[model samples]
Target: MSARRQRWEIRPPAPADVRERLGLPPLLATLLYQRGLLDPAAASAFLAADYATGLHDPFHMRGMAEAAARIAAAIDRGELMAVYGDFDVDGVTAVALLTQAIGAMGGRIRPYIPHRAREGYGLNNVAIGQLAADGVRLLITVDCGISNYAEVVEANRLGIDVIVTDHHHPPAELPPALAVVNPKQPDCAYPFKGLVGVGIAFKLIQALARYGKRPANLRGRDMLDLVALGTVADMGPLLDENRVLVRAGLIALNETARPGVRALMAAAGLAPGLIDSGAIAFALAPRLNAAGRLADARRAYELLLAGDRETADGLAAELNATNRERQALTRQLQARAEELVAQSGRAEQPLIVLASPEFNAGVIGLVAARIAETYHRPVVVIEQGGETSRGSARSIPGFSIIDIFDQCADLFVRYGGHAAAAGFTIATAQIPALEQRLLTLSRQYLRDDQLAPRLMIDAVLPLTELSWELYAGIQQLEPFGQGNPQPILMAPNVTAIDPQPTSDGAHLRMRVRAGNSVFEAIGFHFGRLAEALQRYPTIDLAYQLAVDEWNGQRRMRLLVRDFRRAGGARNGG
Candidate 1:
């Protein structure tokens, strides 16, 4: 965690007229207004979260017709089809969802997830050749393939038609596949252009179901569990259509009778019915991604599609062990990267770029992400390969890290990613040049203020004002992620009582009181605050209000984000 004291950015209060105009509670209206929901009708629609009203017709997406027709033709002909996905959770869930959906329609479809260390990202000709040899007449890529032009051509040469269904940014020239179904394509006008890979794959399933009555009655809603898992795990925006999908998906996830989901929840220490997007992002996603990072992603894909409880439990335990291994390795690599940064005297630079043989290519992205979060700057961490090196980049909120590659497009062998994260391959000899070029670019593009991280508080609400009713209203903003965030409420002059490190010695647990209202607060990773709280008993708090459910009892709790001595300086990380 970053030790730097985050500069607080509190939103200005909402207009008083917003309450009467929207006909909602004061706090709910304020939260909605703060999120730019001013119109009465729009606010109602947003709060309703009605799936039918919110989700667009799948055919509304540009390539839906073509993609759906091609897949339908394959199924009608009884051709062997495969869903080729990336190694991450987003790709794994996508492969599972599409495979199951097609199989339910009497199509023999299997999943193929690339190994992060071996076959690498996107499509490889060798894997495509292997799939072709397995009698696969059709290949549909989920979460990837927008950038695999040559691989798609190779599939075509092997007499297999390819359909590219991805959400990543498309190239100037798309693959000559049978169909392309990415929402980010230049000509695509998907109202919500932010569907992650599985979200796009879900839309393809919806489109295929619309082809006929039998497909329509395939119980597609049962698959929302996969959609929610993938979307939140991949950091997709939680607004517009995505909000509706995820809200319903959470219901599906909670009520899922699938042995795989049940076992995974148990493995993650989550109550079956109490899971949320946060649990998915923090606990479930990492464990699922661990298989890809440390071993074969097929383990996770198989886990999601497992039929029996024993099979599911075995895979879930494997993923749990792999996650533990991944965590230990991440801690080790993070220390080394930080040590390298301290030694390089490059901590003050706008962009931190480092390359070493010790940095494993599979986990460099995690290291870069942690570095970027700690320093609030763009970061590039590369693994020194024999001749060509692979690098992963993480950016601050407003900056597009991929732009660093776009500006230096001529130097890389291959590159693709989103605004905040990207990956590239370049000649090892060109690393110094890449660093200097990145330095030159970051100076022109980044400002000093942007380098200092800001903690954004949604609104200021004293503890006395929080209530069970208000918490229920907040539920309307379900499945919060990238675009929509959980409300962070600020309460000033909070008195800290009995503040101390938790039993595990990894967090801070304390009782907080504001006026007559009191709440139990827990600060994960803020265990060091015990000393500061002992000195300054009175402090201000930035926190998210949550319900702690235990033994069938529930009570309001404060999940502390940060705190500082009242009228004094904030605690440094």
Candidate 2:
């Protein structure tokens, strides 16, 4: 089925003098202004995101002093410490970061990652008991444990000290851990609350380093590569301290000499220099996550901690194959989910809830996210077990999945996530009632227009303005991800000279002409638009600037986002 038509909302350009005031090109200034960076100092700081000035003080986060002190004491006393983490990329990277840091500081450390299909997310009593039996006295959790009130109690009962370092939304009642180092905590005064699990872990190490207790070789910046991987993989907003960490981390990532990192990059077909946030998100993160999605995530964690080239290469190859398998399975499940939604005649419903006993529990989140993006609505995919079902949900922009789960708290055994994504567990018998209740709530909260995707265009420029200088200036905004996305520019009255579908009929490629200028453009997944473009060859296109390299020469290209017939009545904007 064709995707829903998108509504365009073009932002007005900033004042002309913004260029003079901000010392940037007019287009760059306009983009920055639209992002609320109007002051010159702020714009300059954003453009030159130096880590030294950008990263927040580690001690500013509430509970940092206590967490650091406890960790230092444990190191001094030579207590056996265990780093417990989730199964996803964020959790695994956090585990690697903390374990490496602690080991470097002369502490005996072990990493414990729960299996996604078996033990599930967060801290568990069985694992705690096993660790305690192994003589572990200090347990540090990464990317999880915020909502594990009962598990925290279990750890305490086992005589294990727990320090929770997570970025997930905290519950009304906090856990009874020794220290909770989360910026989202109510009493926390941390300036940036958008740190991912690894970012929080980095801050903890930073605090330890400041106290002169960290390993001599393990500086805060040395782990920025891990920080960038986990933060970008988890979709943390690239603003404030997150921006600083990611920007610096990208540099570290490109220059990293770690055997595992180099091997993974080679497998992902990425070059060694000038890696960006997009590369990590699209190439590296998925391969790392493939292990957790299909099997044990410990392989991935060990790969990042691999000390030998042969070991790293073998792990990277395994993960690459797993990622390929994962992609195939995800596509199969997504097609099945679409058919189910269509068969149920719930096409117009605000929320899409799907479930099957055949569904793989590990891949439900990926399928839910894909369906939500395609339908432009909130989606929930559940994997039915014997008596209970596990569910993963993805939400649209305005709807908060976590907030919605909060409203229906009684429906699930346990639930936790961010604004746009979440997971839960409930009895299989409650599926029908949960679906109906969710539909009712969605109907009340969502508007008709909210169901359609909305494209926010930053500026409307003519083809004549597409100069190399403009593109170079825009490149200053590196490491774009959540909260700071690549700018989308609109060009109107571009005549479609010729449009043809790819050989596989999965995409549309064409040459567009504006006056005397011609530009090549590709519309991914827009093969269905070939016939329409033939009917009306003139279009107003929204796209992001891209460069195609051929024979070591760079040529401009347009990555088509959306388009409409030329001279049509402007809608939404």
Candidate 3:
């Protein structure tokens, strides 16, 4: 870990009366109150966000009625439809859910996922015209098409009506689709605006179930497994309706009999049980994404839609192999990008731009993300093709990459992304100008302090307060990700006991003691801190509680996030 002060923004103490009224442990109450669940009514609602009761009315979205009516008419008329999607996990699952739902509703829905390397992201006139020529009368875009102004016009000219069910931020001039269904639209009035592409697609399915023809057994709730997969994979905020969706979706996922899901879990080495957002994000999503990153994403889509275990298993193995290949490529590309930045003296710039004709376009995003995290700087990695260049950018906190790119949008062929991560395409001739403008924008938006990594500590506690009850209490805020993260607790003045590196010599396995309490703690990548452990007997440790299961037994373990010397000194990794 890079050297930096571990800033502890300790939560203010809640009123004693509120803790007593909630009948929660003081620590639990403090954590909850710090997360803005102070009042009893708000706290109750958050904890009790069940899917059945928590989902907003489908019609609450602005274009739901119109979109649903059009889809219903198509289903009634038996007009062929297509579900166009992007290449990421969110887009693939969105395509799967919408295709399955509409197909079950007696609509001829075919799935179309654009090639990441060839078609790039979002709608294209080539794919649009091809689908129209193939007799697709209606096009429903999931997770994309928010910025396909010209492509939507092409589809219209080809006599195809489009219902864009996306979650991306739309520009001022909306696509002239049949109905635009995105909560982020300025004129829209959706109660919850954090739905992923799959979440929005699920909402459309729910509306179709209510207003259109469907099989008696085609309950939209049954699709929560896919909803959970896509939502968690996309890193949507685990709050509001999203919390309800994920909470119930996890249940559905654990109990799902879908052969494709089962096979995927097996390939990922995930045991048959409950899975959290972490599992989806780290294990499942990566394997699914590998297909798109290194090969044809259609394999992943087909894996999800696979009917037999044999087919699903074969597809799962392919994805696993692709994921491994992607990992190797990422490591290789990261080294090259880092060396380029260092050798060219580009690391001193506020914005680091590394470009190479040899860089694989598919893995530039992953390389950019890794470099950005390592240096704690805004990074843009551009892959130069024969005539065009594609760039993926990752930003540190306080710097909005998409906003910065918007300031220089005229140089790009196309660009769209969120605050932190974005991708764009431009002609090779514009690379120098893009670099200059990006450096200028970064200087304007980033401060010196923002370049340093800062770990935010949620609360401070003594080891004596650690207990199974407290651990379980903190877990009430489960399904943590993005907007709501796993709480990081600080344990102060713990003496290191039996401090030693693990067998690999990359991590430290040790026992720490505070007063009369002793607990086993493992610090990942903390082997470099052996000298510091010997120098500073006492340290303040930041960690999140994790349950380690071994030999059919479960025990609480501390996964150390960061540590500092007890007396205001930097200590460990």
True lDDT of residue 195, candidate 3: 96
Per-residue lDDT tens digits for candidate 3, residues 80-148, read: 999999899999999999888888888888999989888899999999889989999999999998888
Between 1 and 3, whose lDDT is larger?
Answer: 1
Looking at model 2, the pairs that clash are: none
- The lDDT values for all models are 0.87, 0.89, 0.86
TM-score of 2: 0.97
Candidate 2 Cα misplacement greater than 4 A, ranges:
1-4, 16-20, 570-573
User: Which residue window of length 10 is worst by lDDT in model 2?
Assistant: 1-10
Cα lDDT tens digits for candidate 2, 1-573: 112277788888888777678877788889899989988999989888888788888899988999999999989899999999988999999999989998999888899999988888888899999999999999999999999999999999989999998889899988999999899999899989999899999999889987777776766777889999999999999988888899989888998878999999999988878478888999999999999999799999989989999999999999999999999999899899999989997668889999898789889999999889888999999999889999999999989888878888888888899999999889999999899889989999999888978888898888878999988988998779999999988888999867989998979999998988889999998988888898889888888988877567999999889888777445443
TM-score of each: 0.96, 0.97, 0.94
RMSD of each: 2.3, 1.8, 2.5
Per-residue lDDT of 1-573 in model 1, one digit per residue for the tens? Answer: 222378777776668777789888877788889889998999888877888778988887877899899888888888999999999989999999888888888777888888888878999999888998999999999989988888898999999999999888777789998889887888777888989999998888888878861343447778999899999998999888888888889989999978888899999999778889999999999999999999999999889989899999999999999999999898888899999999998899999998999998878999999999888899999998889899999999889887667888777877889888999889999999999999999999999989988887777788888889889988777767888899888787889999899887779999999889999999988887788788878887889988888788999999998876675333322
* lDDT, ranked from best to worst: 2, 1, 3
Worst 10 contiguous positions by lDDT, candidate 1:
564-573
Q: Which candidate, 2 or 3, would have the higher TM-score against the true structure?
A: 2
lDDT of 3 at 288: 93
Best lDDT among the predictions, by candidate number: 2
